[model samples]
Target: MSFAADSPFKSISILYRKSHIWLNEGCIPCDLTAAQAIVIMIVCDFSTLTQDEITKRLSLDKSVIAKTVTKLEERGFLQRTTNPKDKRTYDIHPTEKAWQVYPHIREQVEACFCRMTQTMSEEDRQNFRRLLDTAARAALNQEE
Candidate 1:
């Protein structure tokens, strides 16, 4: 499946695949895959997001989040507590173990972005971010 060199959608898809591979490699020593590390980071950063919220934020399937959260919990990197207002839902939290390694995780994330955009000027980087945000929101809004 060849896409035109000038196609933005093709570029975005290629970027996502490359980014996933990069993250997976970087996360290997952390005893996590790229997706698991991403989930842990999200929980650590939010500190109070529900499973449903995580699914929406990552645009992943609920079952995938459930499995990832379960694995993290088993690894002592995360804790899930039932939401007081909704017994069926659970709020995810990063454990002390997760906090201890968060700096490394953060650095890995930053390094990936830096490497990806190393060739771009500051202005271009900012514009790229703005455009991505706009496109992402527009895509999500259209789904509603």
Candidate 2:
């Protein structure tokens, strides 16, 4: 249940925080939080996606995403409007602000990610990413 100082998980966690902090600090002039940035990225790739859609995409629960999306909507970053085709469902739509900021934010984040990945061998990197995706899918497919 615990990790030593040099464990991969611990190092990765610290690196995650470092990268997140850098992203937040770099992306200014936008009323965006890192969480909101994540939502925007997901919605961009999966437009008109619903709360359940985001939850499934991010492997998070609906209530948590609902709360985050509510804040994003209130801040004018995203809109969780009712799906006109199916009023019973709602979908996430990005605002102009989100569209404008996405490219820069994604670039910065990708640069940081590249910096991290540079340490990995090409084969190991591909395998690691695939395995991570597999694990994520398995976790997401589990019963709620």
Candidate 3:
């Protein structure tokens, strides 16, 4: 019933951005850039996604993704292998180091978020997720 401007999306987004400072600090155990974190998170959740597939899911700028993937590969976190079915395309696979770090990263991110929301009830969390999704669509899917 309300417009995107009327939603609490801004507050939620700001909160996430602020909390993600931990991700940006150079001291994080992951030793990863924000872009690397993004790539790692995506692959951790959905194993064996193509670069193009990641592009669509993230809607991130192609250049940023390319730089991030290159850095990650150079840092020994992942690698690009030719797609068996499509010679022109490449698939990303996490390295042993990436496999080892991913579980820890997932745990840390979850713990950070869980600690932040310790007071919220289950129903409230569910409602917030639904509202957030609706608000995100409204905000991001604006017509020209």
Index of the highest-TM-score prediction: 1
Candidate 1, residues 1-144, lDDT tens digits: the string is 557467978888878888888888888788778898889888888988998888888888889999999998999999988899999988888899999878778888877777778889999988987887898888777756
Residue 125 of model 2: what lDDT?
76
Q: Best by lDDT, which number? A: 1
lDDT of 3 at 94: 80
Model 3 stretches with alpha carbons more than 4 Å out: 1-9, 25-27, 130-144
- Model 1, residue 111: C-alpha shift (Å): 1.2
lDDT of 2: 0.77
TM-score of each: 0.90, 0.77, 0.76
TM-score of candidate 2 relative to the true fold? 0.77
C-alpha lDDT values of all predictions: 0.85, 0.77, 0.73
- lDDT ranking, high to low: 1, 2, 3
| Model 3 worst lDDT run, 10 consecutive residues | 18-27
**What are the per-residue Cα lDDT tens digits for candidate 3 across 53-103?**
777667777787887888888999878999999999989888888887787
